[model samples]
Target: MKTVQVNIVTPDGPVYEADVEMVSVRAESGELGILAGHVPMVAPLKIGAVRLKHSGSTELVAVSGGFVEVRPEKVTILAQAAETSAKVDVDRAKSAKQRAEEHLNHPNESDVRRAELALKRALNRLNVAGK
Candidate 1:
């Protein structure tokens, strides 16, 4: 099977790097799927899960918005924040989700947007973690 090198990175550092058979992610425009020898392009990503397929299995990564750069032989995800399922802290994610929900329920108006984003991120993490 053909494979392409995929690198998921954040300002802090790289989160994942490996050769994958396919990469699926949520872009700002919509969902996208990339395979080896894919056309080169760049797209902004939304806060969601990035699904990596390789070796007949799939791995998941939670991303808090960013951009993906795709090439014929490689793909790079430059995210503001990212965490693999194995790295996600379930407790923390749940706590964040709770806090965000509380803020939304009693929205200060100013914090509404931030809280919404936080809720999305927390949900993404929990989803990726399968919890």
Candidate 2:
């Protein structure tokens, strides 16, 4: 089976590095599925799960948003924040979701947008964590 090198990096450091059969991610335009010899391109990523397929199994990585650079044999995700499913703090995500929801209910104009983005990030994390 052919594989592509995938690296997920954040400001702090690299989060994941592996050779996988395929990679799927939610881009700003839409969801994209990439194979070993995918065409080179760059796209803005959304706050969502990055699904990696390898050895007939799928792994998930949650990303807060950033950009993905693709090459024929490599994919690099430079995210603002990212966490593996096992590394997600479910309790913290839930709390953040709740807070965002509360803020949304009575948000000031400026805070409304920020709160909405926060809510989206929280929801993405929880979803990726399978909560």
Candidate 3:
């Protein structure tokens, strides 16, 4: 069986590091699926959940935004922020979502985009946590 070394890093520290069969993430172009022996490339990632497949199990991780560096033997993710399902607090994410929505209602032109991104990050965490 082939495997690719995967590492997910955030400003705080490494969120994940492992050898896996495959991984998938939301790239600027869309969802990009990477398997062992994939072509080398670099892409920007959107605010969403990244899925990784190991032997027979899958894990979901949420990232606010990031960049993915792909190589035949490894894949590296540099994320602005990241969270695992077990580490996420559903209530907190819900509250964040609500706050973001409220901010959007006020519609500050300068902060509207930031508010939307906050909502996206919260929703991504909720999805990863299966809330």
TM-score of each: 0.99, 0.98, 0.95
Task: Rank the models by TM-score, top first.
Answer: 1, 2, 3
TM-score of 3: 0.95
Which runs of model 3 end up more than 4 angstroms from their true locations? none
lDDT of 2 by residue, 39-121 (tens): 99999998899999999999999999999999999999999999999999999999999999999999899999899989999
TM-score winner, 2 or 3? 2
Estimate candidate 2's alpha-carbon lDDT, on a 0 to 1 scale.
0.96
Q: After superposition, how far is residue 48 of candidate 2 from its true place, in Å?
A: 0.7
Q: Report RMSD (Å) for each prediction in the order shown.
A: 0.5, 0.6, 1.0
- The number of clashing residue pairs in each candidate reads 0, 0, 0
Sorted by lDDT (best first), the order is 1, 2, 3
Q: Which of the predicted structures, 1 or 3, would earn the higher TM-score when compared with the native?
A: 1
TM-score of 2: 0.98
* Best candidate, lDDT: 1
Shift in Å, residue 100, candidate 1: 0.1
- In model 3, pairs of residues that clash are none
How much lDDT does each candidate structure score? 0.98, 0.96, 0.94
